[model samples]
Target: MQTHYEQEERFRLAKKRVDELKGFYGNLVSYIVVNLGLMILNLMTSPEHLWFFWPMFGWGVGVLFHAMKVYGFTPFFGKDWEERKIRQFMEEEKKRNESFKGE
Candidate 1:
């Protein structure tokens, strides 16, 4: 039911999605490993001061956003929202073009 181009396009989109997932997972793993190391170092050097949580919290926030974006947890700016906006813009453009052609 689909053309070669359509199949290829679907494959490309799927591959891109997989790549995004891989990137998010890689970022998460790095965050965990680095934060764990920092926590241990902080505990070993300055257990009283306790500064590891700062970096951990900041990086954790970044990772959370990354995961949200990759997982499409963004309610307002998700794929559906984007597609709708794109269609809206295209309709507006088409109307404008038709008006110009009529003139």
Candidate 2:
């Protein structure tokens, strides 16, 4: 059986993992967004008949990533993986601290 200490430790670890993942992918997402808009503009102006395919394919991939991040309930990973875990950690910590102070 798990104890409170164990649960707290697990929560802390989960938050750390999410923070690390966010650090790694956060910038990548931004880069992809900026480059993607430019790519789309190019596709629109390009003379090649199929230049649009590249941005369309890239956009579909981006949306799929967003979907997995928001609704995914996986622990310590996936799209909303980090934010959700950190929010839970903060809420638990806040509650624990509040109870300690009789707040």
Candidate 3:
């Protein structure tokens, strides 16, 4: 269990992380949507256009990568990922408790 101070600090960090994640998500949306619209525009205009296909392919790749990061197997969970700090604290707490109990 975290002390009050530790909890407060964690909350602060979490809020900051949430803000960062929101910004990241927004940027991802803009990139994917804009590029996709461009791809569609190019397609609708001229299917035989070579350049359109390449930019579309590039944008598709970027969208796929972003989608994977946002929804696929990511350790961060797309949020405030303080796993290392929390794990370290838990270990220390366990050790402290064991010492107290003379384990």
Which candidate number maximizes lDDT? 1
- Tens-digit lDDT track of model 1 for 25-52: 9999999999999999999999999999
Model 2 agreement with the true structure over 1-103: per-residue lDDT tens digits: 9999999999998997787567547645775786677677776787575465565667667655654554454455765767788999999999999999995
lDDT of each: 0.96, 0.71, 0.73
Lowest summed lDDT window (length 10), candidate 1? 71-80
Residue 80, model 2: lDDT of 76
**So what's the TM-score on candidate 2?**
0.34
Where model 1 places Cα greater than 4 Å from the true spot, the runs are 95-103
Question: Lowest summed-lDDT stretch of 10 residues in model 3?
Answer: 70-79
- lDDT pick, better of 1 and 2: 1
Model 3 TM-score, 2 decimals: 0.45
Q: Candidate 2 or 3, higher lDDT? A: 3
Pairs that collide, model 1 = none
TM-score against truth, every candidate: 0.83, 0.34, 0.45
* Steric collisions counted per model: 0, 2, 0
Name the regions of candidate 2 deviating beyond 4 angstroms: 1-4, 13-17, 20-28, 31-52, 55-59, 62-66, 73-103
